[model samples]
Target: MELPEVVSRSEWLVARKKFLAEEKEFTRRRDELNANRRRLPMVLVEQDYVFTGPDGPVRLLDVFEGRLQLVVYHFMFAPEWDAGCPNCTWLSDDIGRLDGLHEMQTTYAAVSRAPYEKIAAYKEQRGWTFPWYSSAGTSFNYDFHVTLDESVLPLEYNYRTKAEWEALPSGGLVQGEQPFDLHGMSCFLRTGDAVHHTYSTYGRGTDSLGFSGTVIDLTALGRQEPWELPAGRIPAPDHHADGCH
Candidate 1:
């Protein structure tokens, strides 16, 4: 089986030191990007959208829970679906106790297009305690661009319009995927009774937020290790039989 070249301790240390320098530079770049993101201008949220929460109908401002800042995860759970999106569920599983956000005066909640009953039942089944609300029959999802329906609004995903997305070779939402739902996170700032949309990230923008995803991204062989073949792709006979070589 093929493996990373074996090296003496000193040689390995030399390579490790080089990689560490790169990692440090990456951290600095990330810090700069974060600063710029924070400086982004926000838009006023003028819609009077209401979402169904555990306490019944709650306005968009009420979802903030009286916090100065709010982060809403646009979970993809259509009203027709029996459960939430698996990818969204995976990320939700990574969420830890959110009490820390309260300490920072930032509230966190999840909004989905599914009905309250389905969301409650599924949340109970998954043992999740975070605040999740239903956006059914409202423009909440459409305004946020999570639930895509050309009839309601233009088709856009991850800042890419329908034409732009179709022009991509193999990325973004393809044909026949319209009127669909995609997952993302949106940040909002509350000033008195006004709520403003500060920032939103979709696609891979939200991928690295999870601990498991971050760890995997740090490795030389990322989540795309060769042994992990795509569906229907046959592996070679001598390929690492258990994929643990």
Candidate 2:
């Protein structure tokens, strides 16, 4: 197996120091980017999207759980699918107690296109405690562009159209794949009775939030997705929503 060159302790320290400098620079740039992201404008959420939860049907505002901010995981579980997307489950497995988020006046939840019964069954099967809801028979998924149906809404994913995606070499999947649900994270802010859409990210944009994905990213092999450079490091799995698309 290939590995990094082994060297003397002193030599390794020098190389580590050089890498540390680069890492620090990257951290600074990332801090600036985070600041810019926080400053991005938010949109007013006018649509009254309702979701079915364990307790029963609830409006979008109710999903916030009276929190000032809401972070939603657009889980990829189509209405017809018996189970959630494997890739989405991969990320969901990393979700632990979110008391920290709650303390910060934020509520985290997962929304899927599957029926509440299916979502509840899967959630229990995986032993997940985080709130999961169903957007079945609602436009919540369609409005968020997570559930793609050209007949209902124009095709758009990760801020790109079908044509835009097809133009890319790795975008062939989008050509034939339609009326499919994709995974994403969307943030919303509640001010009194009004809910504002703060931010939404899809595809690789969600990588950072996935603890498992983030840890895998730090390894030599990376996430083993097709888009990663030095390709064919390993056989990429058939990932539905969260993987490269």
Best by lDDT: 2
Number of clashing residue pairs in every model? 0, 0
Per-residue lDDT of model 2, residues 1-245, tens digit only: 34567799999999889989989999999999999999999999999898899999999999999999999999988888899888888888999999999999999999998999999999999999999999888888888888888899888877778787667655543434567888899999999989999999987778777798878877867766645656335524422335523
- Which candidate's TM-score is highest? 2
Model 1 C-alpha lDDT per residue in residues 136-233, reported as the tens digit of each score = 98998888888888999998777778787666654445334556887889999999999999999886677755777678766655567455555336
Per-model TM against the reference: 0.87, 0.90
| Worst 10 contiguous positions by lDDT, candidate 1 | 236-245
How big is the RMSD of model 1? 6.7
Could you tell me how far off, in angstroms, the CA of residue 179 lies in candidate 2 after the best superposition? 1.4
Pairs in clash, predicted candidate 1: none
The local distance difference test score of each candidate is: 0.81, 0.84
Model 1 CA lDDT for position 89? 84
